[model samples]
Target: MTPADCPEKPVVDLRSDTLTRPSAGMRKAMAGAEVGDDVYGEDPTVKRLETVAAEMLGKPCALFLPTGTMANLVAFLAQTRPGDSIILSESAHPIHYENANLSMVAGLLPCVIHDALGKFTADQVEQRIVREDDPHLSWTTLVSVENTTNRGGGACWELHEMESIAALCRRHGMRLHCDGARIFNACAVTNIEARYYAKCCDTLCFCLSKGLGAPAGSLLAGDPETMHKALRFRKMLGGGMRQSGILAAAGLYALEHHLGDLAEDHRRARRFRQALEAEGFEFCLPSPTNILYIRVENSLRAVKTLKRRGVLTLAHGQDQIRAVFHRDIDDKAMEDAIECFKQALALPR
Candidate 1:
C-alpha cells in the first residue's frame, strides 16, 4: 500500500530526513523568488544560490541540480571516461542506492572496499587501484567517499583520513568525489567547516533536501572547469530546469536557517539512542549524528509494530531498524517515539 493509502499520519517519522517539509518561511521565499530560465543561466536567484553554495564549499563554481543522484551522476560524467573504474565504500549511497548509475550511465566499473564504519583508509584505496599498465583491469580514475554515511548509522569520517585519501588520489592522478548527502551533519558533529571537507575532494555533492530541509535540490561543487563540464552533463541528463529560482530560493532559505539547527537533531538522536538502550536495545554503531540503527531480533516485526504505534522507521537489514531525525520532528514527538519504541520492543519475538 502507498503512504497516501494509509489511514493514519505518523506521529513521529524516523524514516529519513528527506521526509521533512519546507517551513512557512521557505514557502514564502519560494513564492517571492525572481525567476528566469536556469537552463540559459538567466535565473538570478539560482545564480545567487549557486554562488553562495560555491563560496561556502570553497569551490570555484557550483551547479544546482534536482537531486543528489543527478549531482553525483554529473560529477562522474565530468570526471571519468567510459570503462574507467571508481572505488567507493561497500555501503556507499552511489554503489548501493543510486540504481548503479555509475556503471549504467557513466559506464564506469566499481571497486568496493568493505569497512565496518563506512570510512576507508588511504591504504585500502591504494590497494584497490588497478595498475594503469594492465589492459585487463579498468584503471581506477576516481575515488568516492560518503560523509555521515547513511548505512553506517551516520558515522562521520575523520578529516585526516579524508585528507590522506585525497592526497593519494592526487598523487595517482585520480579524482576524488564526495557523496556528501548529509555532509552538514558531519560538520555539525565534528565542528569542522564545510570548506575543509570540500577541499579534500576534487568534487563534492550535498543535498539541500535532506537535513537542510529544502523542498528539493542538491548542489555539485568543484573547480570551474569541472563544473563547466558538469553543466553540460546535467542538461544531457534532463536536469535542465527553466524558472528554477523557485526551488533555489528554498535551498537558499534552508542553507541560511536550517544549517545551525542540525546539531539539535543530533542531540535528539543521541537521546533517542539512550532511550532505546534503556529498553534493552543494541545499536549497530554509535550515532554521532542524526541517523541511528537499532539491532532488533526481527526488523520486520519491529517496523510493523512501530508503524502501528504511530511511529515510522525503516528496516535497515534482516535484524536492524533505522531511525533518522530531522527538523520536522520535535521534542514531544521524540518523547512519543521513545514510548512507542518501548512498547514495540515489548512485543513477542
Candidate 2:
C-alpha cells in the first residue's frame, strides 16, 4: 500500500523530502513571477533560474524540467545512442523507481554495478567498459552516479571516489552524468561547493522539490552542445512547458533562502537516529543527512503501527522502514515522532 493507506491521517509525515511545501516567501515569488512562453526560450524567470543553477554548479548552461526523472532521462538521451551500454549502481533510482525508461525509452543496455553501498569505485567502472570493437557487445557510452544515494540509506559519495570515476570516464571517452537529486544535501554535509563536483562530471542535475523545499522543478546543467541536445530531447519527451517561470521562480527562491537550512534537517535526522538507538532501535546505516532507514522485524507492520501513532514512514524493504526529515518537520514534530517510535516499537506483541 502507498503512504496514503495510513488508517489514521498522519500529523508528521516523514515519507520523503518531496513532501515539503513551499513557504510564504517562495509562494509570493511564484505569484509575482514574470512569465512568457518557456518552450520558445523567452521565459525570463526560467532563464534567470537556469543561469543561477549553471553558475552554482559550474556548468556552461542549464535547462529546467518538470521532474528530476525527466532531467536524468534527458541527460541519457542527449549523450548516448541506441545499443549503447550505461553503467549505474544496482540501487540507483533509475534502476528501481524510474520504470525502465533507460532501456525502453533510451534504448540503452544497462551495465549494472552490484554494490550494496549504492556507489562504485573507478576501478569497478573501468573493468565494465567494453573496449573492443566487437559487433557483439554494447559499447559503454555513459556512466551515472547518484549523490546521497537514496536506497543505500542516503550515503554520500566521497569526493575522491567521484573524482576517480570522473577521471576514468574522461579517459575512456565516455559521458559522465550525475543523478544528483540530493546533491545539495551532500554539499551541506561536506561543506564542499556544488561546482567542484560538477567540474568532475560531464553533466549534473539537482531537484528543487526535494530538500530545497520548492513546489516543483529540477535543473540539468552541461556545456552548450550537450544542453542543446538535451533541450531537443526534453521537447521530444513532452517535458516542454509554457509559462513555467511560475515554477522556476519558486526554485530560484529556494536556492536563495532555503539552501542554508539543510544543515538543520541533517541535525534533526541524526538526533532522531541517536534517540532511537538509545531506545534499542536499529538503523541500516549512519545518516549523514536527512534520510534514515530504521531496521525492523517487519517494515510494513512498523509503518502501519507508526501511522496509527501519528507518525508516517515508507517501507524501504521487508525489514527496513525509511524516514526522511525536511523543512516541514520542526523541533516539536521531531520530539513527537521519537515518542511515536518508542511507543510503537515498545508495544506488547
Candidate 3:
C-alpha cells in the first residue's frame, strides 16, 4: 500500500519502509499458519510470536498490534493515567505523526522537547518534568524515547545514554517508554543487543513491517501486568484480532530471517547517500540507518521530476526530501534512484 503523499509506478519507491509488500517467503508462511481465536487468547501461532518476540526483547510479555501506531498508543495509555503527560522529543512520531492518538485515547498530554538531532540527556528529561503543585502544569508521568529517531536523521542513541535517562525516569517515579519502530536499525548500526536497549525502558514497541519486511504487525513488550493492561487497551481500540495467527506467522518469519539483513539496509542507505553526494546533491548528513534525508534546491520540483521518471519519495518540506531503503530495494533500485535524482538536479534553470 502507498504510504506517502505522492505516488508513482514506483520503479524505486523509497517513501518509507512501510510501503513494502509481503515477500514471497512471508506469503508462504502466512498461508501455512496455524490459526485459532486470538481475542479469546487461544491462537497458538499468534501466542508463539508474542512469546518469542518477548523473549528476544527480554521483556516478560508482548502483545501483537496491527500497526505500530496502535502499539505506541496502547503503551501510552497503559503506562499513564488520564491527565498524565508523556515526554517525547518534538520530532517524535507520537507527537508529529500519530494524529494525536495519544491524547484522544490515552487522555495524556504531550510534553515535547526540542531535539531534532535525536540527542537528549538524562538532565534533559529531568528538566522537562513538571511539578504537581503547579495547577497550571500537567502531571508528567512518562518519558518516551525513540530509537533511530525518524526526523532525527536516523541517528541511533548510545546505550549508556538510554540507560541514564531511563534510570532518571525510574528515580523520578515516571515510567519510560520507547517508540523503537526501527530499533533493529539502531542495533544493526551500533552493534548493540536489542535486549540491552529493551532493559533500559519500562515498555517499548517495535515494528515487524519496516526493515523486517513483515506484511504487518508490531510488538509491544513490557512487564506482564503492564502488558495485560495493553491487551485490554488493544481490545478497546478494536485491535484485538481473531485467528490472527495468519498475520503473526509473517512476523515470526521476519524475526528469524529479516533481523540480520538490516545491516544491508544501512549499507545501501550509505551507498545511496554517497552516490547522491557524487552527483552534487546535498544531504543533511550520512544516515546511520536505512533512512536518508536529502536537501534539494527545490523539493517540490525534484519530487515532481522524480515521480515523472517512475521513482517515488516524499518531500520533508519545501527544501527537503526523505527516502528509505528496505529489503525489496536493492542495488539496481538504488542505481535508478540516484540516476533519477541526478537527472532531476541536472535539469536546466
Pick the lDDT winner: 2
**Candidate 1 lDDT tens digits, 48-101:** 999999999999999999999999999999999999999998988888889999
Measured by TM-score, how close is model 1 to the native structure? 0.98
If the candidates were sorted by their lDDT against the true structure, best first, what order would they fall in?
2, 1, 3
Each prediction's whole-model lDDT (CA): 0.91, 0.92, 0.87
Candidate 1 Cα outliers beyond 4 Å, as residue runs: 4-7, 347-349
- Compared with the true structure, what per-residue lDDT tens digits does model 3 show for residues 180-249? 9998999998888889999999998999988899888999999999998999999999999998999999
Q: Among all windows of ten consecutive residues in candidate 1, which has the lowest summed lDDT?
A: 1-10
Clash counts for the predictions, in order: 0, 0, 0
- Per residue, candidate 2 scores C-alpha lDDT tens digits across 197-259 of 899889999999998899899999999999999999999999999999999999999999999
Candidate 3 lowest-lDDT run of ten: 1-10
What TM-score goes with each of the models? 0.98, 0.97, 0.95
Off by over 4 Å in 2: 1-4, 7-9, 347-349
Displacement of residue 146 (Cα, Å) in model 2 is: 0.2
- lDDT: the better of candidates 1 and 3: 1
Evaluated at residue 263, the lDDT of candidate 2 is 90
